[model samples]
Target: MRSDLQIQQDVQDELQWDAILKAAEIGVSVKNGIVTLSGTVDSYSKKIAAEEAVKRVKDVRAVAVDLAVVFPGTIDHKSDSSLASVALDALKWTSFVPEERIHLQVDNGNITLEGELEWQYQRDAAFNAVKNLQGVRSVINKLRIKPGPSAHIIKDNIWKALTRDANIEAKNIIVETRDRTIVLKGKVRSWSERSDVERAVWSTPGVLAVQDELTVSL
Candidate 1:
């Protein structure tokens, strides 16, 4: 039997080993069963990959993920602006936008933007603008936002994405998004599909974070 601290270290080591093997390029540190991961990945999928890799290791009591989300770490105005543009495009395309109600600013790839929308859709649109873009560190969403059609629009979008995806069935799931925070509940075919639904929610505009309450049907 291992002490609590030793157990944590073992888990960290296991997680680190898996992360390295998975080529996620993360640094792992353990302190008394609390594991901290530090590194960057190109997308949210990779970020979660590192976490899931660690969870697969036995004897891990809990996890503390401090992984820095980054995309290639090359600083350039072009890259920053491109990321900003994509974020902005996501917002613009969403049904929740008041169009002229928004303004955006980017500094060395850290985005601080503002807008006004009729509902949560605008906020979700704003979130979608930056979700997986390269060179983003933090976002300060200063949208004078509201919640109405914005929320409904996101629901519609979720339904569409889930229905079209072979791994998911819309009827089995319920989605509630506010200020870009998605809460998913229902059943899915596999762990992979669960992950897929989470990813889809993250990719959508205006989502700040995701909370998945889905169970595996099989």
Candidate 2:
């Protein structure tokens, strides 16, 4: 196991390595295996980038992001209405996002997405549609996934996908379903494999939610 100080140093280095983030504007701290990132970035995308960078580091068990988005004065500030229009337009252009089913609200550069969609990917698409807008400070995804298919079918499909993916060790994993929700339990060798397992579960047609109980043994 890596020491907290070592984890902190690795997270800071990872942040510096990510081209999207200004490393000097971010503060990194670690407690046990949890990494907390604080400071400010110019865009919500950068904030997310910093978190991803930290997650890529070894021995990191969790991340708490406290970064704020502060746009520089050089850029023209957009009114809430203008930002809403642009966000809506972006959603309309995104083929995967059902703009009609999703509703958007912008308040002080914070975008909120609320509504319902049939698949987890569609809900994710709606958030991606507005996350990088010029004045967006943060995105709040309140979009719910509409339940689809039966629990048994959903669980079976997830198991098939997990077993088929060479990156995941399906035998070590257990799949349970509560309605449209997938409950994953077991262990994986690394965070990447854990993510792969979760991704596979989300891609199943009827999954509305996932309870990821897998632990990283490495």
Candidate 3:
């Protein structure tokens, strides 16, 4: 196991290495493998990048983002309607996003997505569509995955995916499907393995939600 100070430095270095993040403006602190990022960034996307960088760093068990978005006066002075229009257009242009299904609203430059998507990646793509808009202060993804049937099949497929991934030890994990939701209960060696397990399950079609209850054994 690595010390807290070592994890702190690794997270800081990762922030600096990520091209999108202005590392100098971000503060990093670590305690018991949990990294806390506190500072200010020019854009919401930059703030997200900083947090994601910390999450990817080795030995990081969790991330607490306390960073604030500090937009300059000249950022995007457009009306909220114009911002919404621009974001809607961007979503339409993105091939992966189901432009017709997901509905969005912009209030004070905060985008709120509401609707159902077929897959988690599609819902994520909907948010990414307008994540970097000039006036976007933040995004609230209220979109829910469309519920589909066959709990038995979902359970079996998720189990197979977990066993297929070499990084995850399938024997220790339990897969339970109730309706369209997947409830994962088990212990993993690290935070990364838990994430990988959840990602694998989400890739299975007809999955509505993932309830990850996996504990870190390390």
Winner by TM-score: 2
- TM-score, candidate 2, is 0.94
* Candidate 2 colliding pairs, count: 0
Task: Flag the better candidate by lDDT, 2 or 3.
Answer: 2
Could you tell me every candidate's TM-score relative to the true structure?
Answer: 0.43, 0.94, 0.91
**Per-residue lDDT tens digits of candidate 1, residues 1-218?**
34666655555565556633344366766654445778666665556557777655444445677776555546442566687677677666766565567787877666776766655455656666565565666667676534334666777787788888877777889987765567899887655667678777755655555678886663
What lDDT does candidate 1 reach at residue 136? 66
Scored by CA lDDT, what does every candidate get? 0.64, 0.89, 0.86
Give the CA lDDT, 0 to 100, for residue 63 in model 1: 62
Using lDDT, give the best candidate's number: 2
* lDDT by residue for model 2 (1-218), tens: 98999989988888888877889989998998988999889999999888889878898888899998899989998999999999999999999998999888888999989998988788888888888889999999989888788998888889899999999999999999887878889888777888899889988887888899988775
Residue runs of model 3 more than 4 Å from their true location after superposition:
189-191
The segments of candidate 2 whose C-alpha lies over 4 angstroms from its true place after superposition are none
| Candidate 3 lDDT over residue span 1-218, tens digit each | 88999988888789889988888889888888878899898888998888778867777777899998888887656688999999999999999898899888989878999998888888888889898888888999988887665888888888889898999999999988878888999888877788799899988888988898887774
What's model 3's overall lDDT? 0.86
